[model samples]
Target: MPKQNFNEKLIARLKTNPDFVDESGELLPAAVKDHAWKLNHDLIKFLLSDPEIKSTFFDEIDGHWVFNHNTFIDYINEKNFLANSYTQFRNKIGLNIDGKFLPERGEVSLVWPYKDCVLEGGQTKEAEKRKEIFFNEILAQDEINQMFDPKVLTNWKRHTTEGEQDVTDIQRDDNGTIRENLIIKGNNLIALHTLKQQFRGQVKLIYIDPPYNTKSAANTFAYNNTFNHSAWLTFMKNRLEVAKSVLAEDGILVVAIDHHELFYLGALLDEIFSMENRMGIISVVNNPAGRQDAKFFPTAHENMLFYAKNIEITELGRLSLTDEKRRDFKYEDIYGKYKLNGFMRRGDNVRKEDRPNLHYPIFYNEITKQTYLERQSDDDIKIFPIDDQGIEKCWRWGRDTFALRKAKYIEVKKIKTRYVIYSKLYEDEYEGEKAKTVWNKPYYSGQTATQGIKTLFGSRVFSYPKSPYVIRDVLEITTKPGDIILDFFAGSATTAAVAHKMNRQWITVEQMNYIETITVERLKKVVGKKVKEEGRLLEDIDYDTGGISKSVNWQGGGDFIYCELMQYNQAYMDKIQVAQSSEELVALWRDIAENSFLNWYVNAEVPEEAVNDFTALGDLEAQKHLLAELLDKNQLYVNLSEIEDADFAVSEEDKVLNSEFYEIR
Candidate 1:
């Protein structure tokens, strides 16, 4: 019989000890506390009790059996044995120089220790059956550029109100700028890099709702967790680093996340964008009723971490006030309906010592109901901005501000013995109110998103789709009509649809097979063309009435280009995924060996002896998985420079489009 893997062997050894093993024969975490070097004698005693373990793991030295603690720790921490599989290829793929793992607070910067490959996160179809490929992030500086070189785009088609048409040639403006909106189907990390060549520092807004890694939510060591969290951070860091380069100096990045990885994602963002550029964290009540299965407090909200590329240059848009908000301005005047606010500062740093310049007296003319920065008359009452408790406080405005706006905005009111200075807050002054940190609108709920999808597709085709209104509001505040918006994690293409309706150019990328069945299909509906109605014989020729289309008065009339990264080895990888039997897998393996670019560590020639060893495994899944590991991840797609190469079988039409897309002569 074949020997059990190290994980199996470790479990069996642990089961021999009643103190460590539970009734289910699983190792109790508490029993392993003493396993650390010099922690306690319990682990040593337990190991000694197992004769096989003691013989295999300990060595006889100086009349006593010596335990190799380092080896044991390595065995325990090894990727295969550890709970997270992300570190499985650590020996082959070393950490990138820039990938620093924040293990703990105040800890020295160390290599991120985890690696991400092309398939690190893209496998959303039959998620359980997909095998992952691991590769070095930055094997060498020269090699890294090759790994991220722009890839050739295929399947060029423009969808618009008229209909879909093959895009033979791309149109560019006087400055050679591609004005078409885009939707790319491929791995987002690679796509982001591909976009870096053309779109660097051009995207106005990037909004993403990436995977929360909710499985690891229970663990509180979010920033420092070795397995799942580390892997997640590594994946995020790779993409975010590239994403930052693609953003305009005054651009904004908004990431929607829940409680699970909030702190961890926040820390990572702080490291990348610097905490100084962090704009605000908005709490959106996407589920008003709250999640029923929550362990403690029912979660009714998720947070959006907003950051500006350069805070100094960033300008935020405003929202029109509702009728209810207009009521807040209670008083009326020739200027507009207004409200009175005391000029005295109320919050922290209100004392005269904090702002001595704002502590000066304001002389009030009671008869004229006017205020001045200086003494107008000897009879005029001087207000020092004192509270009822006899404590001094500084005015909200300085003397310069008082002089600049006192004629139009200041009003002095006398009540009993004291004269009070007030600033007239006009309704027109706040015609467009700044968006607050909380959004509890009913339209922002996840249910609204679900219902919208149902209206479009007649069923809930995607889960947790963000309400298009949410994207609409987000786009409203961050971009203009022609600004470029990018969403790499393009679930259901909500951002793209909203951007299209709002007249902003957008680019969204998705790797899931559903991108065809759901993402693009949804976009097609949003672009709107003649479609057969369910109840009538006539085909309705109109824009999609669902989502933000009606809200924005969108009678859609625009176009977007849909394309994908030209697959090279990725095509063979797909065949590997669907190969049913051992016979099919063997045939695919032979083809891969002849045509594919094998990984750096893999030898092209399979030794006759190794073939016998592989056959002996007698497992189809195992053989298929082993075959997948041999393909080089870096060559998943054909690079743009290699379009002329006959080996990749690039079509003549694709060559023309590629040349035009890249603006190459």
Candidate 2:
């Protein structure tokens, strides 16, 4: 008889014994059930036939079939297998949306609308045309690595007294030690990785207010071109992974996010920080009145996700008591100011049956007016928790606990012939209230954030900047003086300003053009002895010194180093920016072709002779424009490894700096 085919034999065996596959054990590639059990046989066979899919997703270990975790994720992403229903794919992989399961979804991909579009597609034809003309291209792994590879921190200029005053002497502390505060101007992800060379595992606190990506035209803070859900997740994942590596063992990460991506960000955090290290979510009400443009209930609050590198060693700080809280401790005694607390467990499950051990009675001396934990041979007097309303209550502490710490409790007075027992909680013993989950106070609102930036710059240059007070409050709880604070999304440098005022070292990174106009200017103002407006120190104008600057006694003395990421493609870009006419731009294009290394991902099919062909085009302006567009803007920074290439002339000084910065021989 002829041997049955693989699938036929497997199906017959499966019918006889359901566990015939032995999924947990090693099996040869021919006999292995690599695809999900629910998948169609034809689909499985088709996937296995594709060389890329088979080689990437399926592996052989000692001639035994094995699955490649990361490659499988890539395969799923490339094929859009989970496009129809995520729940179906998740169930097949034994994973839920929260990333919890017997086998976790190690990597994830969201269904982006325009992800798998081709030039010949129906709806994507216009987009394909736009790509042929001008559109952003996502950089490949090699291109991204080469573009962001470590470069020297050059053009080190320090600001001390504002007014563009450059101080050569570094400011030293009382111990004659000089601390460096950094303001980096570049892509935050690349900057963070570069910073890792010197700051790995040294940062104490990281507070970031990343772009909310609201995808609303009304939201001015959103990026010009909205990143799709999948791209946004990937962007955050890359940065957060690097951020996690730079945090000290007991360090804390606090991210401020809105309702738009809060759930998605939370899931990402869960995957990165793990459930055990998640501290808690704090709801901060930045808009009490609520935003008016909502389909349902208007959003009034944003969430702050807190996580620790090592929860076991992490210590939470407390907030100082307010005047209203101080009034509660009115009574004073030899033990100092104390508050009388009812010694009964009055909330849910307060009955005798609820807590049998705490149901025991305490002895009260009617004459001495003192309560004792135990009854002295039934002669000392008994105090049962019967209120004036004739309701029974239970003791706050158990019998053994109350016996050991009876000095804290006292019988104060008799009310309607029944002795009233109380516990004296002293003021000195109380540090402060633990920070609550909900922050609805007026100071935590967006109005305060606006007022803060206005106070510093005298104009609202940045939209929706975070309040320095709120950042200070977070720092007070998570970090101490002299701790290193980092903020990669330093839009207006509010985190750095707060850190400087609080006497902590800080590093801030910003990529926008306003880094110099808004962020750097604000930091200079923070260090200024006097506020300036219109390039002149203002004395008559009533400037509102409302933020932490005044309270922290900030003066123009401390210094911060300012640096920009070295340029590669931007050098050609500079020429493009300053081109007087189309002819000059055409010449600059030829210069780019010779000197600049184009990103491999940027229309690699375009012939090198296209530059010469563009010059012959009748529309000189269009030819110039297309030439400028041909270079990828994303490959702006020259990799340190490529600095020595003949195309990029490396200066000896910069070479030394780059080598030392990366600690490379």
Candidate 3:
């Protein structure tokens, strides 16, 4: 066959094969195409097992045979094959709409929309904003790598209940796991990449309440929250892709978002993690009374999307019984609290004909109130599971189950002429129950969260702080003590504080200027101190009493290491944003032109004509924006490899800590 015709012939053969259809009767090719043509290696292996398919692609080279991947990929790309197999299959399955333009209807894959571009998301401070960089602008991987190199960490301090101490070295456990809880201040995207060097496949759980992109003051993020829909998606996509690499194999990720981007976020996550790994979406009623400004429906709920790094091996934790749930256990015994459950089946497959084996008779003694699978004496009375209408029903358990736990667990009761068998359902028998999809509780309310933060900070310094109870419950259900939990969007340090109180190692990163004022201070207070009134200690009480402190018994004495990504050109950007007038910006521009690393496209000489043009723009904000853009985004932070360079003023203490953090010699 002609080399070009090889793919056409192979596609024709695959179309006729019945093995291409899955158990659900969906074409496997269609499913694969939905996922950007990234074939499931297992399915590829299985398909190659067929002699007809194997012989067509496998070529014997010397002593071994090699499957021609390019030829197979070409076959999968054949338009006629996909149109006939995928589009027709969707239509047959009732997924098509006459007027709708579904993304899947096109030849392009779902992730292709943003795949060809990269958003710089270079906003390192609250005032800075992102710039889009197309694939064509990105010359090579080397350039991208240079921009994302491991950053140098400075200002390392270990905080304890006693006081803060300079940290020259990182503490690691016997297994070489970093023992210190960490709070790093920088751009979260860059911070995540830095963390991946040491924490790849090490985090147990990651929970982030990221920017909702709601275009409202209530939910605005510090790193420029006014991005357009596609820009917002690209921003999230860049961070989420890195976040996935940092997750442990069995780690769980939970993302909190409002309705503004819920559907789009879901689609993005599906593209990144695949649908098979998706756990479920949880609806949390954070606003019980609802927002008054809502146009139609008063919005009261936000969603949490849960996913696992590998769903098959991910083990979920259970939630403790609520007061309402505890009420169900009405009876108590020496063993513990328990309730009576009907031994007879009440739902589907309850009919005797449905499960004839379970419909067998059981002997019951009225005096003893005990149930037996078989009669022991004449006093024993035979009973059948029958309803009031005289319809026979099957026992919930089969004969084998009844015989196994008949003495201790099964109980027989008599009321009038009818006999009922019950099973002792002990509350202690189960550790706890799985959390439901909807979580509506008083403690989960937004007002409660605001009040809690006010109590901690003496005022509400932050907007919409997440409730500590929410974070506590998240940790309780998803992690064990000592497992690392990460929250890149660590607003107000709620995740870190909760993680510390719950006994999990944590890492939080924030880029906003408020990280020092609010985020770190919250964590420092979490480590324990007496409540102060006007900078004076009110009492000898050594631990915080607000939020979940009493619930988790957090008489906190833990500590965390705080550090910052040493700024390079980012310093100039900060100065530019703070400049008040055109004269000040002009003066700042002079300093920037001499000292800062400018974008490759920006002229280095600070041409007098260009300076005159900059002055002519009279608008201070416009001048500031232009000056900020002139600085190179790639050199925002000092890279780890440049720590020894004297021009950046690398302190000896910072160099030691940076080496220890990155595990470099």
Each prediction's RMSD over C-alphas, in Å, is 8.9, 13.8, 15.7
- TM-score of each prediction: 0.69, 0.64, 0.74
For residue 121, give model 3's deviation from the true position in Å: 33
Cα lDDT of candidate 1 equals 0.73
Q: Model 1, range 1-665, lDDT digits (tens) per residue?
A: 22245467666766676755544454543245233444357778877776766776688998799887766654554434533222222222321123321121111111111111111223334232212222212223233435588999998888876678989677666766677889998878888889887888988999999766563322212221222344566677888889999899999999998887799899999999999999999999999998777878889999999999999999999875554667878988788889898889999999888888889888888777777777888878888978889888899888898899998898877778777888898888864768899998888998899789877787556667798888888998889998989999886899999999899989999876677888898888887876556755344457678877766888756788999999988787668766677678767767887888876655666555556555554655445555665666678899998998989888888888888888788
What is the lDDT of every predicted structure here? Answer: 0.73, 0.63, 0.73
Pairs that collide, model 3: none
Ranking 2 against 3 by TM-score, winner = 3
Candidate 3: segments with Cα more than 4 A from true spot: 1-145, 221-226, 376-382, 412-419, 530-541, 607-612, 615-618
Give the total clashing residue pairs for model 2.
1
- 1 versus 2: better lDDT goes to: 1
Q: Which parts of model 2 have CA positions greater than 4 angstroms off?
A: 1-136, 161-179, 217-226, 310-315, 322-340, 352-384, 397-421, 426-428, 530-545, 549-558, 571-591, 600-629, 632-635, 638-665
Clashing pairs in 1: none
lDDT for each residue of candidate 3 in 1-665, tens digit (9 for 90 to 100): 66446545554544454545443333445333322234446546755676766776567789676766656544554444444333332233222334221222222111101111111223233342222211101112232435678999988888877668877678898877788899998877778888897888899999999877553445553212112354467678788898999899999999999997899999999999999999999999999898867888888888889999999999899987766777899988777889898988898989999999999999988787777778978999998989889999998888898889887788777778788888888888858978889988899887898778777776556767787888888888999999999999887899999999889999999876778888988888888765667887654546567888877777868889999989998777667656788889878878887888865645666556566666765545445655665566678799988999999999988887887878887
